[model samples]
Target: MTDGTTQPKPPRPPRRKRVVLADSRAPVTVLRTVLELEEQTSWAEEVVRGFIRTQFWTAVKLALLVIGTLGALPLVFFLAPGLSGVTVVGVPLPWILLGIVPFPLLFGLAYWYNVLAERHERDFVDMVEK
Candidate 1:
């Protein structure tokens, strides 16, 4: 026995609106705003890049400062006079290497390096900005 069934109808066609392409000749107002935003973004990016360079140079200088300090240790002791009890226990003042002098010297050097590094970068960026 065969059963006869009615077939379902097809879906309706889709509706569409007219398409528009971007016009090359934009209005003066829109173009002006775009230019303003672009300038703002350019300035911001320049600031960010300048900051990056400054920070990098600072790191490099700091590393060099540290290395220089460490390297000078031997020279400092070598140049010190033989023990004369000017320091306690007959230990020469120069013997006070890591315990005293080097620490402060390293710190001072670090501060100096950082300041100079920051200044140089600031000047460069300022120049570019102008």
Candidate 2:
């Protein structure tokens, strides 16, 4: 057995590598699944309709609240004409309420609505996922 040629060695296989991600536990979305749901069930449509209704009612309610609060101010001034002449720090009360106060109040309402709408969307997503 000494003088002959040797057999060739087998080739080595490639090494497997692991991948790291920034967020491992995030929920995954599939377009195919969503499309299937849309085509196959009314549930998605109902959920969207419900979401729209919730948003619409929320907007309506906030609108009414703003209108009522600001509208009543004018009515109060008209009913009590002496109030218009009253001043605080040399600024008319009506001007303070109508001009200065409303901007902040409206901004607050808009912020609240944004938060509410986001919460609604989150809830809808949760429901859909379930």
Candidate 3:
């Protein structure tokens, strides 16, 4: 009466350290791996500080560019009043510059910021992962 089919083996216990809950019948859960920063890890701290400095400088540069451009509009208009009178298909140059031009310029700046931030993050990740 032996058909020769072998039975499956039982599951093995987990290898990692696990903490069982206070409940009488609760299952054991594996501990999550956490980053230890309190120890003497000056290299990691330096890398983080450098990354933050790079980000801070990047933001300051972009802000100066945007603010400088917008701030110069009044000076340009003041210096060259004729520019405000110029029209393109019945719309004044000032209207075009102030209303229509900024959207694309802002979007371009935002795109550049996203690219730069991603690059910074990628470099940071590579340094840490290595």
**lDDT for each candidate structure:** 0.68, 0.83, 0.79
Q: Compared to the true structure, candidate 1 yields what TM-score? A: 0.42
Model 2, runs deviating above 4 Å:
1-37
Q: On residues 4-97, what C-alpha lDDT tens digit does candidate 1 reach at each position?
A: 9777899888988878553457666555545544586765566667777877877887888777877776675667545323575666665676
lDDT by residue (tens digit), candidate 2, 1-130: 6668888888889888887643445445544336646685576677678888999999999999999988999999999999999999999999998899999999999999999999988987776664
Q: Candidate 1 has which clashing residue pairs, if any?
A: none
Best by TM-score: 2
Model 2 CA lDDT for position 109: 98
Residue 31, candidate 3: alpha-carbon lDDT = 15
Weakest 10 consecutive residues of candidate 2 by summed lDDT: 21-30
lDDT of 3 by residue, 1-130 (tens): 7689977888898789878644444333211101322342675577678999999999999999999998899799999998989999999999999999989999999999999999999987665544
Q: How far in Å is the alpha carbon of 49 misplaced in model 1?
A: 2.0
TM-scores for every predicted model? 0.42, 0.70, 0.68
Error of 3 at 71 (Å): 1.1
lDDT, model 2: 0.83
